[model samples]
Target: MEHDGQLELYTAVADQLKEAHARVRASQVPEGVRMALTRKLLVITAAAKHDLADAARRLESFMKDLDEGRIPEEDH
Candidate 1:
């Protein structure tokens, strides 16, 4: 991905995570609302966590290459 595209994607993900977290935190909402929002939050949280983990793995691989005095390449 281009640098700008990557930044935009990350920003959107962050905004979604914040919104989902807030929805889950609103305890005054009705049970039905809470249930629906909790599901949404869980889905988004899982997705975001997955993305983060992948990024971490890539970074680790890149750092390992750097330590071995080699340039890292894109995973894809």
Candidate 2:
């Protein structure tokens, strides 16, 4: 995808996740249970963000290689 499209998709993903997290936070639950659940959710979100960062790094490297003529561009 083009840069603008990728950015739009990334923004959408972030917004959706934020909205979902807010909804979950607003739901009523026992304090202990809610704390445990929120902790797990935090771990999951952190892992996802880490993976996204790694993917972004790989994409950046790929784009740099292509731009520097170190990799061949496909005839798409």
Candidate 3:
């Protein structure tokens, strides 16, 4: 896939995460548990963001390698 396609996919993922976070924040739960859950969600969201960045970097690198004729041999 091309860079634009990758970017559109990433943007959709980001939008979904934003919507999830908003829903969690808007929940009407007990105070202590709500705060704890919110914090945990924040950490999870951050980790997901990091993972997404890493995936994008890897995809770009792979594309570059392919463009440069660095394809590996297929196993029969």
Candidate 4:
């Protein structure tokens, strides 16, 4: 039962990650911003391997920022 719940959460997060990638790709942001966002997604993806719940929270915050037009500055 607990395992099944975890599996469902994993599946949902995976699907959300796919949609987030697509949204990033289709966004009209500058290249640098896009790259930064991609890096963030990559980190979230890696985190999911070790901590699904944490990764899901991170991904949710990321998506919320994106939806709210709160993009981070590009790294130097």
Best by lDDT: 4
Kindly report which residue pairs in candidate 1 clash with one another: none
Could you tell me the TM-score of candidate 2? Answer: 0.47
Residue range 1-76, candidate 4, lDDT tens digits: 9999999999999999999999999999889999999999999999999999999999999999999999989766
Q: Show pairs that collide, candidate 3.
A: none
What are the models' TM-scores? 0.42, 0.47, 0.50, 0.96
Q: Lowest-lDDT window of 10 residues in candidate 2? A: 67-76
**Best-to-worst ranking by lDDT:** 4, 3, 1, 2
Task: Give the per-residue lDDT of model 3 (tens digit) for 1-76.
Answer: 6888768868865665565457546755556645654554555456556676654454444445434655443322
The sequence of per-residue lDDT tens digits that candidate 2 reaches over residues 1-76 is: 5878767756754664565456447745455644654554465456556675544444444335434544332222
Clashes of 2: 0
TM-score of 3: 0.50
lDDT of model 2 at position 32: 61
Q: lDDT tens digits, residues 1-76, model 1?
A: 5878767766766665565456347546556655654564555556556685444344444335434644322222
Q: Output the TM-score of candidate 1.
A: 0.42
Give lDDT: candidate 3, residue 62.
40
> For model 3, what is the error of residue 13's alpha carbon versus the real structure, in angstroms, after optimal superposition?
2.3
Using lDDT as the yardstick, the better of models 1 and 4 is: 4
For model 3, the local distance difference test gives 0.56
Error of 2 at 56 (Å): 14
Model 2, residue 9: C-alpha shift (Å)? 3.8
Number of clashing pairs per prediction, in order:
0, 0, 0, 0
